[model samples]
Target: MKYFIKVVLAESYKQHRNYFNNKMIYVSLFLWPLLSFLASYYSYKAFDLEESAISYINSGNILVFLLIGYMAMSFFRSVVQSAWRFSSERQSGTLEYIYLSPASRLAVLMGNALSSVFESSVVMLVFGILMIFYNRESLHANVVGLVVVMPIYVIMALLWGVFINACFLYSRDTDFLFTILEEPMEIFSGVKVPVMIFPGWAKLLSCIFPLTYALEALRQVTLNNSDLGTIKITVLISILIIVVLLAATLITIHIVEKHVRKTGNIILF
Candidate 1:
């Protein structure tokens, strides 16, 4: 276990070092999150809702939902980034060379996941701080609960990342799936609008998407300033979903990897 940690950390550090050397990546890493936040904020402003309404929203209550919803979206971004990046490397035959090394596949995946995760977290933190300042509201929530729930969300997201990477390993064309999933998630997961606004059927469908639970969980912390006790139901549901989805995702990955090898199409691209 200790050896594995050292390898993963070394790989992750190497990846980070390479990323830092790329100027475009560094600029995009800083700009994308701020741009996303500004885009959402401006879109809302364009609605011309009264200032009073907007100010009330800046309150910790409403801002928390937005904060968490974006965070959940960040997971989706991480997975897509990982999948595509991996696929690109595979297409260039670089991934094949990497796999020949003695390093663990999980360790390599962690390195990839870390690259994307860093970008996503940077975006989230930037947007969150901006929201706090814009609202001029001091935020408070269950610090302990936030800490507990975050790792679960990351685990869930990582499962999806694994599943997607597995798909790319064989099909090498899951970009369509990624795009389709991302668009709907952005629209229906209550990122820019409240889920309450969705009709019953729409809300039900959206709930089927994992991002809904993530957004709701974060909203509990950001908007309601609620503790773990207050939001136990949502947390419980999220925990259950994460467990089931992760298990299924991992199984699918194993099956897919084996299938690709058997078919000799692991490099399908």
Candidate 2:
């Protein structure tokens, strides 16, 4: 138990010091999402939201609604970008040495994920909270639901990062994974739009992302003031996603190790 805790902490410290050594990173992290959020919010001004299909959207609550979506998105999106960044480990030749270490590989991955979650979205999260407070009048949130769901939201993002880190372990050329996931997650996960308003095929694609479920439940509780019972299905789906990702991460780590031993190479292809 002590060794595992040490491994997690050591990896977390390495990740933090190696990539997030500068204070300016926090400012940049907040700015990117803020720009995206502004662009998205302004684009809606050209339309009449009251006439929109989604029942909850209106001029009054639109600002806060969008804030919640973007805030939830930051948690999941930052982790994806972090995993993609970690791919450079192969180029640096540190990944092989880390794999050769005596520590548990899973602990190393978890630690990386943990570090990603803590720093990547913090600035954005704080900004979002202040904005939400400003527009508190526009919200209809369930206090209990928000309290319960917040931890799950972070855990889901952490597990997602771990799963993505495992997948990126296969190869150095992981730009394709970055390309496919980042934009698609933003679009299909209903960050700027609601899944309920999406076309049939688009809705089907949205279900493929765990972000879709997380954001949906988040909006349900925050915008609609829905209770735990009302969002039981979404919560169940999130739990299932968490379980599947944890198992897949473990399996992928085993595969990565085997491939390294057999080929004496860390890069899969």
Candidate 3:
């Protein structure tokens, strides 16, 4: 257990150093989200949605609604970033060294996932604070509910990252997978709009993505002032999804490791 803790911390420290050492990453972190948020806000305004529609989607505070949705999207995007990092490790030859280590592979992967979450949370925090300052009037929520829900939300997002990383273990290239998943996830997960407004087919797609539940639970708690009890169904679904993804990730890692052992190569292709 102590060794696992050490690995997590060591990995987190490495990520922390890498992130802070590069000034542009910090700039891009703040700039890209801010730009995207503004673009989304103006685009929605151009549609001139009815006040009732806005209220249904975001409690009538489009700024805060978009802010929270974008923040959640950013958090999930970090998981993809972690997968990209895992792929990069393979390309750089460091992945083989890590695989050869005596440490548990699950622990190493968990460490990487946790580190990505940590970094993403920092960026989200900064953007969230800025949004709050800029649109304080748009903010209305049960603060206590948000506090309770956020930890679980972060865990669910990290589980997604671990699952994606596991999938990449068997692939030589992740670009196609990332490309296919990224936009659909953003659109179907309610990052730019409410899932309630989605078409029937889109709603079905939302059911397949765990981010849908996360965003539902989030908006329920933070925007609607609902307690955990009120969103129990969504929370339960999120937990179930996390469990299933974790199981799949474990199975994938086991299969990949066995193949690597037999073939004596990390990259099958």
The prediction achieving the highest TM-score against the true structure is 2
Candidate 1 worst ten-residue window by lDDT: 51-60
lDDT of each: 0.66, 0.86, 0.77
Put down candidate 2 lDDT per residue, 54-116, tens digits, no spaces: 877898888888888888888888888888878878878888789878889888888888888
Instruction: Give the TM-scores of the predictions, in the order they appear.
Output: 0.80, 0.95, 0.90
lDDT of 2: 0.86
C-alpha lDDT (0 to 100) for residue 168 of candidate 1: 62
Candidate 3, TM-score vs. the true structure?
0.90
TM for candidate 2 is 0.95
Across residues 152-185, which tens digit of lDDT does each residue of candidate 3 receive? 7888988888888777776576557788677899
Off by over 4 Å in 3: 18-20, 58-60, 267-269
State the lDDT at 73 in candidate 2.
Answer: 85
Per-residue lDDT of candidate 1, residues 127-176 (tens digit): 67676667645455567777877776777676666556656665666667
RMSD of 1: 3.6
Question: Which candidate, 1 or 2, has the higher lDDT?
Answer: 2
